[model samples]
Target: MSPTRSTRALRAVDAPQSTLSAAAGELIDADPLFVRERTAASELPDPAPLVSNLARSVVEVISGVRDIEQLSRWVTDDVYRHLLIRTQHAARARQARRRPTRRPNFVELSVRIQATTENIVDAVVVLDFGARVRAVTVRLEGLDRRWRASAIHVL
Candidate 1:
């Protein structure tokens, strides 16, 4: 109840290390950049918070055939249903060609997705390969409790 008692209670809890301080110790950089909410969420989350993070992981996961299954795990249910799998099959297969080398190589892609929700959502994503962002698509889905992307059309 007292100020001193409250201060002591707060001090007893372990505090998170500031990312910048941790980075400073590791000698990583001066420019501070970080995506925080790997966990915390409130009643209202951002309209499109996961874009940068998901983009980063999507490349790593899809880099190998073995990891392809992981894609379904991150995405919400019905994403696969709406995704243009049959349509993109040909292009994806073509891109899957392993070059003549000691190991198979998956094509590197930078995927950008824009998502917004009202009663429903419209998501537009562009996958940028070095040559170009070879693919762009718009998907529509009902705004369930969590973000879900369904039905797609290439643009």
Candidate 2:
């Protein structure tokens, strides 16, 4: 065959390869893994329930009704440790003052979710313990499809 005809034949063979490569690239671009990743990343639990549960857990801890294990289930590791230390100190202070630490009588509780990202939320919670009202700011993180309180600040 002439060089011209040989070059044409070579191009004909490579034409299908290039077409196939393009189709394969499209398929990869539309892969299910990408879809799944996007869906998972965007899927976030409603912050209302999470904030309510966290607020209740904090109240339970402050009332001395919930133990460390129970608190751990609702809060992150750092919050758990912080709660333990604070509760211990409160207990010691109560003992020194010879005052009985009464369980808080929760009259009302309200939770307001301030901000939310893909995997994090900031919530403001107000709890009415009959004679006193406590406001708590909670930072929550989504991990393994569950919301856990990463930090809590009471005001």
Candidate 3:
């Protein structure tokens, strides 16, 4: 039709506020030092792979086989600092024992995942280290359309 008709039709339509726009409002220089994005669970990928990979990488980091910096993008600042502290302790223990740094021989046995909320998942990754079994628990939160480890513990 006519331009006037189209303009009138558009004017008659009511538009609603977008969730994306609403979410973006929180990012407007509220805190210049720390800024993080929240993503909907449906917009994220499966957490299983990230959980498994992070578990393995964390073990390697503690064993001095991997650098903690490699995981910085996939974890929160608190988790990064915690992992760094653990890595330091492991390195010190190794130094005390005069053990040379080597990659740990391990196999991922299984992963158990539970969703605590739309944007959060708690998972346990079981690893077999030949002579022993260990479990790594990770809490993943959806951020910026991806998974970031908010908490991690090895036992």
Cα lDDT, all candidates: 0.42, 0.73, 0.90
RMSD in angstroms, all models?
A: 15.8, 17.5, 14.1
Ranking by lDDT: 3, 2, 1
Off by over 4 Å in 3: 1-34
The window of 10 residues in a row where model 2 has the poorest summed lDDT is: 33-42
TM-score of each: 0.37, 0.66, 0.78
Looking at model 2, residue 4 earns an lDDT score of 94
Give the Cα error of residue 132 in candidate 2, in Å. 2.3
Q: In candidate 2, residue 13 scores what lDDT?
A: 74
Q: Name the lDDT value of residue 47 in candidate 3.
A: 87
Model 3 CA lDDT for position 50: 91
Compose the digit string of candidate 2's lDDT tens values, residues 1-155: 45798897787677878797787778877896533121222466677876776777776776567666776776877898888888788778878889886766775467777655667778898888777898988987776666778898777
Q: For candidate 3, lDDT tens digit of each residue in 1-155?
A: 55797786565454345644555566655766556687866789888989999999999999999999999999998999999999999999999999999999999999999999989999999999999999999999998778999999999
Better of 2 and 3 by lDDT: 3
Write candidate 1's Cα lDDT for 33-127 as tens digits.
Answer: 42112221233355354443344344443333234355464464455443425425534665678432122223424344443434344444455
Candidate 3 — which pairs collide?
Answer: none
